[model samples]
Target: MNPARAPQSVPARLAQIALYGVAAAAVAGLVALIVSAVLNGSLTRSGTADALGWGALILGFLSGAVAYSQSGQSRIESTMRARLGEGYRAPGLPWPQILAPLIGAGILSAIVFALN
Candidate 1:
């Protein structure tokens, strides 16, 4: 067995891909928000309101991602049992560590959105 090439199950691979994708998206969104804030210097109430709306959406994604990370393995197991019947086993992602930044972002974004 090549230690460098541990075979991952499809579900595990999918979970990894999903986490990476969401992380990328969150970073991109944060960058865009920063750029928007910098470009729109003199922010009116309406302008800040737009940021609040964006914050809400970002918060939603982060919250869901955090929730998913916390329960995704069990959810996957349950779904597999329901669909494939018992004894179907598969690898699960290390979600809590993977989703830490998203969790932090969710908390911070919620605070900012609330303040705005």
Candidate 2:
């Protein structure tokens, strides 16, 4: 070992997150394809109900998060930032802003993931 060896670079915990995110997304997509194929047969009605239930659970939690809002420009921002990372200003009317992104994304997801 050299006495003048360069210092080692510290690893960021988030570095593997993006790769895993992509991989998980790909896996989810493939599973969705399989589920639709199954839904076309015996699981059709029940599967649709399950999907709607999942949507409701997800949307309700998301709405609650929005309602909670951020502590905005406060002392706890550092704590919140550590937990959720940075926040950005969303430019739009409150109601429409709340509804639009989720709805648009849902619509696009549904179209791409149409069962029939």
lDDT of 1 by residue, 9-103 (tens): 88887677566645654664566467667989756555655664565466457657766765777777778797876765555655545464454
Residue pairs in clash, model 2: none
Any idea what lDDT model 1 has? 0.60
How would you encode candidate 2's per-residue C-alpha lDDT over 1-116 as one tens digit per residue?
Answer: 78558554434323343344344334444454466557676446446545443443454455446544633344355556667877745333344334433453354346445653
Instruction: For each candidate in the order shown, give its overall lDDT on alpha carbons.
Output: 0.60, 0.46
**Cα lDDT, model 2, residue 85:** 71
Measure candidate 1: CA RMSD. Answer: 8.2
Give the poorly placed runs of model 2, Cα more than 4 Å off: 1-42, 71-93, 101-116
Error of model 1, residue 102, in angstroms: 17
> Model 1: runs farther than 4 Å from truth?
42-116
- Candidate 1, run of 10 with poorest lDDT: 96-105
